[model samples]
Target: MRIIHVAVIAMLVFAAAYVYRIKMESTVRTEKVLQLHAEVRKEREAIAQLRAEWAKLDAPGRLQGLAERHLKLKPINARQFDQLKNLPERPPSIVNPGDPDPIASMIEKIDPDIITGSLPVPEAAH
Candidate 1:
């Protein structure tokens, strides 16, 4: 009877120790999760701040002011417009008329069957 009592007490002590260890592990993991959540929140706030700064910098009024200060540009007037017919004739084509199409030539070189239509085409899926 005494031996049975001692064995039961030992088993109870081991179970208590195991439960305490598990609890400690759970607490540590919960703290780590909270720390990660805080870091993510800080990162999101930083990103929001950066986006706000970017929006301020890219505002049309601010950009227009910067452009006017840095770049010497004039507003358009009717005199600046010109008819297309008044323009000079374009330069002549550089390629020779006798030359074959470059893409066709490349296709013929890579696979003569493609140009000849000798390969079997796959049917489209329904």
Candidate 2:
């Protein structure tokens, strides 16, 4: 009977120790979670501050002012353009008019059974 009492007391002590250890672990984890939350909040605040500074730096008025101060730019006028005859001749096209499109032929070659029908192509409005 005395040995059974000692065993029960030992079990009770072990259970108490286990519960204490679990409580301590939970407390430590809670503190770590709080620390992480603080870090995240601080990071968000820093990002907001950086964004505010970026807004100040990237303002259009400020950029235009800087450009006007440093860059010597003039507005475009009719005098800048040249006569149509003076301009270079247009480059020759890779595919001539009425010639089978090389791209379409290659795609047809990849799959012989592919319906190479006239797909509705968007034309440039003259």
Candidate 3:
């Protein structure tokens, strides 16, 4: 009877240790899940911040103001163009009308059967 009691006590102790180990492992897993969730939240916040900054930088009114302050530029008119008086004339084409078509010489140079007909393909030249 005393031996039976000792075995029962040992079994109870082992069962308690098993339950405690399982509880600790579940707690560790939950902590890891929370840490991953926090990291994802931080990344989402960074993306939102970057998008807001991009929106502000690309505003049209801000761009126009920057251009006016930095460039100090103006539009031109026909009055500015008319100020130029003595421009040179363009040269005429150098081709002579009496000359025959240049393509006729190239056609004479190339064999008609090579390009115009179904000829056997040659092997690699290299």
Candidate 4:
């Protein structure tokens, strides 16, 4: 065959092979996209079903009925609350306002006996 004709044939063969590869790739990708779309639709349906179930489970009337049947709670009376004057006084603070905080000073003092099973660490400067 002539040199130019052979080169043209080779180029045609290369172009056909590349086009076939691209077609196959696109087909595979299209199938994968279809599968993902179906999966997403199925998942959305499952979510909708779960939401419906949750709504049924969380209904206030249903919860009240369950509580009444299981808890067996009694109704409250008007006299359940005590008057403000009958309430007990608040307890006094352990450390007086005039005195320095003893608890804070104790927390600041790090114990030397507390070990970390390693080399001695330098204490933070005051």
Candidate 5:
């Protein structure tokens, strides 16, 4: 009867130790999770700040100002516009009509069997 009592006490002690260890591990993990959440919040705030700066930098007026200052460009004038019909006719074709296409000759040099594999086609199922 005393032996049985001692065994029960030992088992209870072991269970208590296991529960304490699990509680400690859970507490550590909880702290790590909280730290990660804080880091994520900080990263989100940084991204918001960068987006605000990007909006300021990408404003159309700011871009036009930068282009005018750096590129020394001028705005379009009414005289600059021209009718498409006023454009000159395209120049004559460079290749002679008698000449065969160079690309076609290069393709003809390769074996047709190599392109469409040497494997026999399977018979069509009924």
Candidate 6:
């Protein structure tokens, strides 16, 4: 009889423990879901703010000002174009001193290992 009573008590304790574990797990999951939703809302707000800032930066008046300052320059007349066309072709003797010969020296200076897969390095300055 005593053994039967102890068995009933043990079963009751196990059932209580199972219910407690399930309740705790559900609470944790609900908290995690709330946190994820909050994070998504924050990211959406940030994206909206960035889009507004981009719109302000691309305003037409600001763009026009920037163009006038940097790239809106133009010649006054067709005479400048005629003068440019009248200029003589440069002689080969005046080859630019700053330019290097890619066909001759550059080809020879290339490392054979770089052409093959044996070397992992990018092409270095000659």
Q: Better model by TM-score, 1 or 3?
A: 1
In what order do the candidates fall by lDDT, top score first? 4, 5, 2, 1, 3, 6
Candidate 3 residue-wise lDDT, 7-117, digit = tens: 999999999999999999999999999999999999999999999999999999999999999997997876766443566676864544564975665556665566555
- Where is model 5 more than 4 Å wrong at Cα? 92-126
Best by TM-score: 1
TM-score rank, highest first? 1, 4, 2, 5, 6, 3
Clashing pairs in 1: none
TM-score to native of every candidate shown:
0.73, 0.68, 0.55, 0.72, 0.67, 0.57
User: Which segments of model 4 are wrong by more than 4 Å?
Assistant: 94-126
lDDT of 2: 0.89
lDDT of 5: 0.89
Q: lDDT per residue, candidate 5, 9-119, as tens digits?
A: 999999999999999999999999999999999999999999999999999999988998899778799999899999999996555566579566556666765647586
lDDT, residue 32, candidate 4: 100
Against the reference, the lDDT scores of all candidates come to 0.88, 0.89, 0.85, 0.89, 0.89, 0.84
**What tens digits encode model 6's per-residue C-alpha lDDT throughout 1-126?**
999999999999999999999999999999999999999999999999999999999999999889889996875885666665778996654333565874565566667655566766667889
Query: How many clashes show up in model 5?
Result: 0
Q: Which should have the higher TM-score, number 5 or number 6?
A: 5
Q: Kindly provide the TM-score of model 5 when superposed on the true structure, using C-alpha atoms.
A: 0.67
lDDT of 4 at 56: 100
Error of 2 at 94 (Å): 8.5
The C-alpha stretches of model 6 lying farther than 4 A from their native spots are: 69-80, 87-102, 105-126
The deviation in Å at residue 28 for candidate 3 is 1.6
- Steric overlap count per candidate: 0, 0, 0, 0, 0, 0
Residues 1-126, candidate 4: write the lDDT tens digits.
699999999999999999999999999999999999999999999999999999999999999999999997989999898899998998865545664876765555647678767787888999
lDDT, candidate 3, at 122: 73
In model 3, the clashing pairs are: none
Q: Which stretches of candidate 2 lie over 4 Å from their true place?
A: 91-126
